[model samples]
Target chain A: MGGEFEGVVRPRRMRRSRRGQALVEFAVVLPLFLFCLLGALDAGLWAVQTSAEVSAVEQAAMVASSAGSSPTSETAPDAHAVLTSISGRLRSALFGTTIKSWCTTNASGDCAPDATQRCPTTPAEVQDVDGPRVVVVCVSEADPPACATPPPGQVAPYPPGCEDSPMITVRVVGFVASFVPPGFGPGASGFELPANISATTHTLRFAP
Target chain B: MRRRRRRGDDAQAVLETALVIPILLFLVCNFIAVMVQVTVQEQLNSATALAAQSRFQAPENAIDPSGTRCCGAPGMSLATAGLPTGCRYAAETFYGTMTTYTGLLHWLRATLCTSGGDSGNAAIPPMQPVAYAGSPSNAEVSCDIGSIKPGGTVIPGYVDRALNPPAGLNVVTCSASASLDFADTPLAWGVFWTPTLHAQAEALPPPFRQ
Candidate 1:
């Protein structure tokens, strides 16, 4: 009876089998394997977003540069119109969603001495019939019209006719979406990714 | 007795998993950190290129003339009158002289003369220094005296300076800067272990013949 009891329970035989060892090893590695897989997925998503940002900026610059004949003179209205249209196009092509945009001329004093006077108006003499004009478009996250609108009652302070200078600066700003999972941890909170892009083009001369 | 022995064996798998999970998590996070840094660097490079190009093609007005002042936009022919001999706005006569006489005396005198000096002495004394100097003064003279003077040349003209860009075109120099933070992730902790990448780019304007 004791010999039959020993035969029925065979714990040593089960412990010595390779199948048990294999099971233990798999359990040990599964967490690590999952971590690696998820990490790769996260990385791939980040790469795709970054590529989209680059392509958008490149396309915008090319479009702005090629707008008209050589040395395109841009008026504030004209610049705003062009940038608004382009921003819409880029939003559709890149994100498949519409995004807010603002356009401004790089009328900063550092880049253009007469930027103040030249920034808002067509690069024409206050009264003269013919002159080259340059307009810079700045795009940002602000809403349209409101984004492009300057502060109220701000008269261009610089002398007139300075607007026709050849140097025009354009800037575009936008947010890049984050890839981190929401509510994961304090570290996984929303991340703000801002991109600023700028380009320059010569002003076109307008006929008298 | 057999049941008690089986319970101890069951805990082995749990203990092994606990020991290995943290290590695997660390490795995965490190990989992600590396990928994020690369993406940041690429973004920086693109931004710099765009900024530089914007600066390069920026309208001529954006450039600070520094000390130079813009006089009236008189017609091209008006630029030559009373200009120092050899001062050429569009006229051929002033070209050789303006190119050779680039000097302080020549510039000050040109400024005083072109603006029609407020006083006679203001005009006479400045010219005296240049008139007495023999054998081509070292001071740089303006080609178009009425259009620009030595004190006024500080404004950089779009077409004036020589900048060698790609394809044999000359361009103006503009600068750009950017800062970015890595996304918050368990992997971001690994960023401290890796190198951050930084880069810059320069662009030039279309070439013009002198």
Candidate 2:
């Protein structure tokens, strides 16, 4: 009976063997383990990207608010140069992507040309006018002051040959890539991860 | 006897696997849960800072650069060809008031939600108020922009708008609260405890400089 049982080769014994059991357990757990590990790595990358976006917006706001040495007319001057100069910083901070800029004199109404089009320019008369200036700076595919006619009797706050005035309205918008890899789940797709920050500050006054 | 021994061995192997699988899974899930929680917390912190900064940097429309009272019509004198051009100020009183009144709360909510964390969940508690140096009720005080320095100060009233006080001769106080649930796994005999984490931050306006 012992010889017959040995020759019969019970498959149950192999299943019970400790070495094979470890292999089976590993196979069962491996997919879940790998999923969690990859999820963590992706999440970490997302966090870093988020941090970078936050810092970029904050820095951009700071730069926009701080007064610069641009020559101005009687009306407030366009701070576009100062804004664009910081664009590179923001872009590099965001991993070397292109940064766009948009500026507008009107705030209540939609700035013409929208986010995708060039920023329309206030009429020459508006630029030459002495009034509050609204400057919208965003990252988009357009130029500022895109040659739009100003309302009758309203002049641009900053015109050529006007003395540089420091008062201006500055709006800044930044776009950063989403941290999720391409072709991820819904939560990760079609998100530009844009940051909109605005600040208004005048030239710093020194104590006499 | 041989057949009985083989059967016993198979039963032992099944028992061992049943025992090990749950523990291993528990460990893995716990690790994932902790990591997600940490990431959420970091995002929350970042949102808070951004929102606070946004509030501190009030919009131009919200402030009266000319130092006019809040009730007065909105407008600024323009600098024309070598002369000041008088222009009708658009009434942005609402804008100013909104910035002062809801700045902090707006920041708190926007920052929290913007980072992909849900505030409405039972697992997460709403932000709570913390007391700083001042009134004992300071723990839960909400001040308006009118109460602070007069409107149109050019500089917005609160340094960090997330802290509730819009403006004041006295200081403004703000509070925030949040909670998150930890992942759980079953044990041999019972279940492991789940954890809830919370955080809060406060800011005071710098004392008026001479």
DockQ of each: 0.10, 0.09
Indicate the DockQ of the complex predicted as candidate 1.
0.10
lDDT per model vs. reference: 0.35, 0.34
Q: Could you give candidate 1's per-residue lDDT for residues B1-210 as a string of tens digits?
A: 766756666687667667667666666666766665555555445544443343223233332222222222333233333232111111211121122112201122121111111121122211111211211222112211111224533222222222212111133222222232333344455444434344444444433211
Q: Against the true structure, whose lDDT is highest?
A: 1
* C-alpha lDDT of residue A178 in model 1: 37
How much is B129 displaced in model 2, in angstroms?
8.0
Local lDDT at B163 for model 2: 31
Q: After TM-score superposition, what is the CA distance of residue A120 in candidate 2 from its true location, in Å?
A: 21
Which DockQ-derived CAPRI band holds candidate 1?
Answer: incorrect
User: Candidate 2: where is the Cα deviation over 4 Å?
Assistant: A1-23, A61-208, B1-33, B50-175, B181-210
Best model per TM-score: 1
lDDT of 1 by residue, A112-165 (tens): 212333222221221122111112234221111212333466433222222322
